[model samples]
Target: MAEPILTVKNLSKSYGEQQVLHDINFSLQKGEVMTMLGPSGIGKSTLLRCLNGLEDFQTGELVFEGQTVKADNANWQQLRQKIGMVFQSYDLFPNMTVLQNITLAPVKVQKKSKAEAEQAARQLLKRVQLSDYANSYPRELSGGQKQRIAIARALAMHPDLMLFDEVTASLDPEMVRSVLDLIKELSEQDNMTMIIVTHEMNFARQIADQVLFLDQGTILEQTAGKDFFTNPQTQRAKDFLASMDF
Candidate 1:
């Protein structure tokens, strides 16, 4: 395998006296879709935050493309440009039209020309099947549409990697599948490395190349999606899969 695009070693984090993650180690190669599966409150989101430099870690190393990420790392903004994230909540600008929201960051931060940004944003919206809703405000769109626009906004940055933290967790049941389908398409079409933290085990089984089973802030098992789901080696993973009835 090639050298990993993201390398995390002995990554640990805490809140005051409580440690949320402990000695976490993982590496993600370019174009790999790695899913982290765990119960709630297991520090899955915390780990993702640390990976993208959102949360500060007191110990260990997070390296993106060979550059180490630390609490006071000065290159964060530069690094973050290549790593995009989408959250469970659709954090759209309520006042901006969908197209504006999608192009805002690229135009303002990346210095993309308005015409260029609009062209790219429109293409992304089309990819997410929301080309018709460009003029709609966030409030005017359904939960799924808002999420797709959020994804389009992320892609507008032209990131090399994407981190999705339960991106569909806030959507209605009917809307969830639409967003998932879009993500599934991303896994098929984009070469972007992805670290997805989600409870959607069925989607994980289908889209993930590798699965990491996390428990109590530790990675219990790391295996390919097929082997991990079909024949999990750890008792914790087996228990988790049993509880989910997978």
Candidate 2:
């Protein structure tokens, strides 16, 4: 399938002597969305962090864009440029304006001209429905608006893969849908390649092309999105679905 944009083979991780992930294996094709779903503290977030190099894995390998990636390898920094990650926290620089936040990476790391970066930043702001907030500070925006700007900052880098770690988890109930809608649009309209870790089950069923149902650091089921919610193959998955309010 076009050589799979990202592949994780026998991937595992641990904190001190306690293992958190056990032989996790999956592959994501270009423009596909894979949602990592499980109960709290089940290593879903850790796996996502490993993929983006925010955390290190103790064993196995990640292949991105046809190259095998090791956590400490020199190629990792270069590969990170193509992998955009948005966290639960809105990590915008408080000192920088929204426009400045989006433009900084492109200008500094990408070596783009300031005017070019600003233009791209403005376009991203428009896409996220925050064009008017370009000159505003992070402190002035609502949680949702700040999150959108964080997403725009990632997009300004022009990533090939997007990693979202419960981006809506920290938002107010009223603000959740807008952020989720934006992500859904990226999947439906822009055809973005993404690996998402989310507790929003309904959104997971709607947006996923594949679902990895994990439990206690291991995958209990990896199935197509449509079949998973309707007819889960594993008992763990069925119990998980049954327990959720949705």
Candidate 3:
């Protein structure tokens, strides 16, 4: 059997005196898609942030491609190269053009030459269907366009795993489909490994290879996608699907 590319063991996180995540455990093999579904204010977003090292945990560890990094002594800089994360806020540099924003990491962090990075960035832009927007600034594009550029920017790094934290949460309803469709394509065509936190039930149903249903900082159910949406194992999961009108 092929080994999982990522694994989290007894991952617990807290804020000051309050705990938000408790003993979280899961694994993701290469080219698999796992969607995290939960009620708002649950630990979903926080968990994603922890995985990307935006927030450090007091306990537990993450193993990526066989290297174990304990939360207490983590240096995610190296791991960041292989793990791409996209936030709902479209955290692009407002001053830089789309091309520059997409190529910055490749050039600075990866130490690729300008010409090489730009060439690869252009290809990513085309892949994201925003080739025409390459020279435009982030301020000029619509929400969906900016999100696409964000995805392009992440892909320019050729990450082995992608983490999306409600990338469509801030978009207008009409613009949400475009971004979601792009993500679906990344799974189907590029075969990217991903962990997505989303509220779009139908999209999750279509794209998730597996489902992680979180509630009150704990995993209520971790089941196959079809089983999760259709025959949720736990009452909390069933109630969650009901609330989403799935």
Best by TM-score: 2
TM-score of each: 0.96, 0.97, 0.97
lDDT of 2 by residue, 127-191 (tens): 99999998999999999998889988998999999999999999999999989999999999989
Error of 2 at 34 (Å): 0.5
The stretch of ten residues in a row with the least summed lDDT in candidate 1 is 66-75
Residue 227 displacement (Å), model 2: 1.1
lDDT of 3 by residue, 119-159 (tens): 99988888888889889999999999999999989998899
Off by over 4 Å in 1: none
Is candidate 1 or 2 superior in TM-score? 2
RMSD of each: 1.2, 1.0, 1.3
- The 0-to-1 C-alpha lDDT of every candidate, in the order given, reads 0.88, 0.92, 0.91
**Collision count for each candidate, in order:** 0, 0, 0
Query: What pairs collide in candidate 1?
Result: none
> Order the candidates by TM-score, highest first — what do you get?
2, 3, 1
